[model samples]
Target: MKPFLTGHEELIHDIKYDFYGKHLATVSSDQHIKVFDLDSTTSSWILNDSWKAHDSSILRVSWAHPEFSSSKILASCSFDRTVKIWQEQPDELHGSGRRWSKLVTLAIESYAPIYDVVFAPNHLGLKLGCVGSDGIFRIYESVEPSDLSQWALTSEIPILNSSLPAKSLQSSFAIEWCPSKFTTTEKFIVVALDQGFIYGTKPGGGKDDLQNSPRQQSPLQQQLEQQPQSQQESRYIKLGNLPEHNGLIRSVSWAPSMGRNYHLIATACKDGYVRIFKAIETAKGDLKIEILAKLNDHKSEVWRVNWNMTGTILSSAGDDGNLRLWKCNYLNEWKCMSVINTSNRSDNRGIEVEPK
Candidate 1:
């Protein structure tokens, strides 16, 4: 892979590619956001726009679905305790260039430094989800798609199911929505705090086609269905939590199910292990999670784990300064496919600030 310099004054915290994979966006501790477009002829990325987006370190950046507008849309969260939305528009003054304009700032309900922000899947409309040091997860939806500045807070839920012994001053979180195209009954999201938790919504109206699925309830399913009617009628509810994590989870990713009957999730944890969980839906609509693999090859605090588009492979990065690729073979055992060591690289462009 070719690497290019971003020319930021400080370290970058997050980078994301747009839905079409033709553009790239990055947020940096310098509090600036930069956008780049891929040059087809040269097969290289060209910087398209750059602007100061926040008052403090920007932690994450997410691209809205391309179908949302003719021009691209982006969302960013920062340690400044705010999230901002931006849209690309022609430079009115310059008349020959394009620039990104801030559409709105969401800070009213923010209580702590925001750590993560992500856009919901395309089918879910233009919704943004964010989590912060306060351990609260908040969702915002566009009140009117055509009017970018108008947004409404639709839901806010604490991530942890049980109270911690005391307040955590170092808490951070990451979240990802299920990217399944086949499931029409409900939408699901997984959040990582000290542990992983799966939250879901009940079918909103009319009739659910999966209503006829077998009614033999699993223990987990029974507990979820036993929640008070208030929770059952809410926009979203806590469906289940994952196995305990040894240390705070740094990142979590839900693999695209690709129409499979099961779901796959991966987590990067400060305990120096990358764990993969396989979740299967019972006939009664309960989710049963089994540990598919526990990999300690990193031997250092892993910071991120992500699945390929097809969910056939996973790539992890960590403090060890190695990017490792993993895949499952015919025997259904996961093994390291390759490792790219960046620790000894002499290129300044490869250097990154370790996450605090």
Candidate 2:
């Protein structure tokens, strides 16, 4: 932890960490993906582990399965309309000093440019989800789609809930599915608007409109239908309509796993507001978003907000060319834990957007 890890060609769009805490990865708008590791004994020193992962600017990258860390799988999506899966090359690192071999790449064909990617809870190791610029959520089944039978398609979870306040294509920046398919009854998704509106869905998520489709009785539709009546109580339940940032909602990430009774969220807004929203439990249909803390230290629009693999803290980045970490206080509020100011003397994050 030498205050910063060196090496990246350009601005970073998102970061994902393995559950094991030893390996971490980042996707950059520069069209590259870098995987890094921290020294076990000295945690602050960041190692540079990188590969040219995509043809165009990368929009998202996520850990495929850290529950199985050695054979590391990282799924990355980009403006090139491709989703790629990368596994660690064995005996790849030359020395103990922080270098690894090129990634063994496999492409998951996508119809459109993918902006976000996530792995579904593992029933089989192959289930994964991806969302594109068109706001269509497509779940790809094959590790390699050319193997069509093994690479079957899952239903697409369309983003525009015809009934809710939909953010037009010109405004959306990211889509995130809950990490755990925790409940057997429903699914959860967080839609981040470029204009700062963050909307949420509960268990039988988006059932109000997701059930009806041109193809009657799709697998997902059946999943929606078969949910026990009791579980459908808040199906498509609209949580808080949080005003995230002033410019665009760059990114949104749900906390990893915590066996708790409530939900917590962290969002990075264009207005440079790194916000934390806590779910207040109740019997009503409205999901309450209590802004537990507001961070205004950055000088530019914040591009992303992600809770660490463990959910105890969150990391955010922006046009400002800096990375900041925030931690929760005993009062359930968030405060700045650490800050990496700039890669060089030239980068600075600053903006004048009005607060949302």
Candidate 3:
């Protein structure tokens, strides 16, 4: 792997690549976002743009599919309790230069520090979902695909289960949408809470109305209901929680279905293990989730997990400064294919040597 100095003063929190992988975006605790462009000629990453995006630490950044709009867009969530949308535009002053500009800012009513933000697939239109310290999951939709500024709060649902205590909720959570290519109208999102429980939900349906359920509604949901009828019709219906983890969950990723009848989800937790789940659809269209595998190769807390574009391989990072890759065999059992040590070694003179 090649490394590039990002010039970030604080620790970097998250990094995301565009749908085509031509561009990369990284967010840092220094409240900055940097974009990089891959130079096809030299096969090296070049710094494209860098800017301070928030007053507080920016935790996560996500890139929207280019098919949703004419230009590329990015969404970022920060500890300042705001999620900002950015768009790439041609620089009028400098010829052949591109610049990223802020398009819109979404502030939650609870004012809790946002943890994660992700954009839905291209087929879902211009929709974004976010989760935060407030234990509320929010979905925002762009009414006009041509205008990114025209966004509406479509759904807001509490992520905590009815049996879980309010104090059990943590300040960090991760969420990802199922990338099933078969269904166009149906959408499913998997959420992992730092309190060790993962939940799935299907938001917005014909009979799912929130007008009469004010007691269970979030502040943002109640506020959205006072808007025009067309804007308040969306609601979130809970699908139920998954098997509990022994420790806090750090990240969750849903693999691309790619015409498959079943969906795969991977989760990394503080227990130094990675768990994979298989969600299959029954003949009647009901979804069922079952534990597929428990991988205990990591010796430290697993921090992040993600799948490749084809969803054939799984990658994970951990606090031990190591990266591990996993793949399935003919028997459908996931095995660790390789391990990369990220920690640097120091010589007798105390000079640090990079891993080769």
Candidate 4:
């Protein structure tokens, strides 16, 4: 692999490729976001834009599908307790030059640091999901494609069990929206919490209203029922929670469904393990999840997990400074296919050699 120096002063927290993989966006602890464009003629990544984006470390960045509009859009979350939306603009004076301009900023009502933000699939109309230190999951929708600044908080759900004391609620670490919708009328979002539990929730109010909708009663609803009548109304229904992990969850990813009957969800944890789950729709039309694979190849905390565009391959990075790729075999067993070491080493000339 060929590597180009990024010159980031601090550790990069996340890197994402655009829908077509023609552009790359990287966010770092230095509170900066940089965009790079791949030049087809020279086969080189050229630095296109760089700017300070947040007051603190930026944790995650997400790219909206280009099909949403003619120009690309991006979303980023940070430790500064805010999420920002960016739009790519053409530089008419400089032909072939494109730059990103901040379009909107979303600050959580609680002013909590957001750990993750992701754009929903193209089928979902310009929607974004975010999880944060407030133990709350929020959904924002842009009603007008021309005016992204007019985003509305479509849904807000407290992810923690209300029966538990407020102090017991833990911050959420990651969240991902299911790429496939069982029907044109429904959507799913999976979230990972620092309390070692992963839960799924469906934002209410689609083609059908919540009162007329049929779904299994979740723990959140049960807790909500115990409260006063004024608090009974909710726009989100908890799907269910998965088995607890050994340690806090760091990242969660849902694979893109490619005409598959079941969906795959991968979670990376502080326990240094990567677990994959199979989400299947039961006869009653509710989601039933079961652990498909538990992989423990990392010696340190597993920080991130992602699925390839085809949903056939999974890749993970960890505190061990290594990235591993996993694939399923003919027997339907997941196994590690390759590992990339990122640790630095000293060479013969007293020079440091970094992993490519």
Candidate 5:
């Protein structure tokens, strides 16, 4: 936990480590993205690459592919009501094969900024989702274009469920995909909401192209609209109450386990605590969830909690400028592994600014 770099005008919204934990990526509201090498001996790792990514404060940065191996795609969400995709063109951008540059830009409703973006884990063919100020969740595809900055909307989920009020709780701050089920029958992505909702959804399709969109045709008068009956559309499965945090649950992440009964999910919150929950089987033979542990050592709002690729190691940072690492014991309870105190400086996770 040495001082990696100093003197930035904004908060660090996010920090992502490569799968092998050998590299690090940090995004700050200063409108700057920095990539660092964990094995650098000179304290200052080479500035692999950077750019003036967003028009406003950048809220989040995510690696759209698996670490080290195939992480050429980078996704960023910002307060400027847009989501942008970047590519790491090794041979062209950086001589060493680790440079990332802007690839695409998605303009959504004005002021409806994007907060989070993440590619589906263990997924093939390249796709990712971004959710932010507008309370809308959009899916983007990695289509190879003559201009890499070009991307298309593969699917757009304006709402996760029909049951929940569409406009009531659209501002989703956290989202995560369930671990690869191996069985294709149950493909789902979990979205954590600010209004105490944790639900799942399967990719249905796209609504309309947000990038390079085409004009629509109103041919309803010719076909009578082929009026159809109202069919039940139920792609989302509701888990249960996850109010372990007193206020809004800020972030949620899962462990890397396949067995249904061997899964764990952790959440950080404005309540200033990180809670771990494991799946439980009920007497009715239904799968349920139980709280494994609650780490309240973070003295300020716990902005985020993320698991390492192994899911055994956890890292969390907050408004207090404290970054902590927690390790799970045999008892399933997690203990503090390491702590990074960047106090006296406002944490990046908190200083994010999103448009209305």
Candidate 6:
């Protein structure tokens, strides 16, 4: 495949691929969103569309499931405290090229700058999850899937359960949905603020009335429930937390189960460490979390951590300007399989080793 230089004037904040990997969406601090399509003939990327999406620097961009609409749909959040949706439409005026049009803008609840926005798994319907400097986890769902613009705020829950002010400008937040379609009963998303916490939707994901039904609670949730009455109550249930992350979390990614019984999540932190957590559901519906591996190979603040499609291999990047690939062996141990240093332009080859 051939590479083309990006036209973004400022630093790119996020890049995401569509569900089928046919299109790529990138957002930048220049307040623009660019979509690139794969050219099947030349195996190269072609700039499909670009537009000024936000008033301030765009922080994140997410693509909805391909099946959600006949045309491509994208969701973006920015420092302007708004989440905007765009849809690809036939450009009647141009006649040849398709163009993107703003579908809707969501900015009612978020008082602070939005940091991250993610679309839920296709199985969960057309929904978007957002988090920002306000420390609120907001869920918006399109009740009428065919009409993408018709969306309503379904839930607004605090990221932290304690009374301590959750709002902070120094901290960043991220959210990732559970991608397992086999998980039929419970639907949830993991949010990363000071640490990683899993929050599950109630019986009905929409604006359902608060139900005090009996349910099993993890030990951590039980402790959170014992807090003072002044603490704000949330509709979403707290599933569990990724403990021992002493510093602020930069990113969190959930791995595709690929038929695995348990779930795997990777976390990037400001403390110069990368952590992987294994979560399993018990018979009582409580989540049991354990640290699978902790790596400090970056020796600097970790920026991002993501898992491969099959959940077999994991990749991490940090402030050290290096990208590392990690994999687990049959013995249930993880090791760094490869490293690519970006500092030296001449020697850019990746040093790779066998997984086992």
lDDT of 1 by residue, 12-89 (tens): 999999988999998899999998888888888888888888999999999998887888899999989999999898
Better of 3 and 4 by lDDT: 3
Put down candidate 6 lDDT per residue, 1-356, tens digits, no spaces. Answer: 54467789999999998988888888999998988888899988888878888889999999988887888899999999999999987553321334888889996677888889998877666778898877788877675565677776656777765543445537678888888867534446555456677876444442221232111111133433464433323445787888998788888889999988999989999998899999997665557999999999999999999999899999999998889999998888899998876563424254443344
Count clashing residue pairs in model 4.
Answer: 0
Tens digit per residue, CA lDDT, model 4, 123-205: 65577888777767777767556676767665666776643224455444677777765542344555545443333333344
Would you estimate the TM-scores of all the predictions? 0.85, 0.64, 0.83, 0.82, 0.70, 0.85
| lDDT for 5 (candidate 5) | 68
Candidate 5 lowest-lDDT run of ten: 206-215
Model 4 residue pairs with clashes: none
Summed backbone clashes in each candidate are 0, 12, 0, 0, 5, 0
Off by over 4 Å in 6: 92-98, 161-169, 190-192, 202-235, 347-356
**lDDT score of model 6?**
0.78
Candidate 1 lowest-lDDT run of ten: 212-221
In model 3, residue pairs whose N, Cα or C atoms come closer than 3 Å (at least 3 residues apart or on different chains), thus clashing, are none
Which portions of model 1 show Cα errors greater than 4 Å?
92-98, 161-169, 190-192, 203-233, 346-356
Per-residue lDDT of candidate 2, residues 1-356 (tens digit):
34454366787767667756677787887776777777878676455556677789997777765553446677888878877766565555633333433343323445556767787554334456676656555555443322312333444445654433333444444655555434222234545354323333453444323333212322343454465644543334445555545655666767765775556777777778887777654565445667678787787787778787678888888777778889878886677888776545523442233345
Once model 2 is optimally superposed onto the true structure by TM-score, how far is the C-alpha of residue 30 displaced, in angstroms? Answer: 5.3
Indicate the residue-level lDDT of 38 in model 2: 73
> lDDT values of the candidates?
0.77, 0.60, 0.73, 0.73, 0.60, 0.78
RMSD of each: 7.3, 8.5, 6.4, 6.8, 9.2, 7.2
| Residue-level error in angstroms, candidate 1, position 168 | 7.8
Clashes of 3: 0
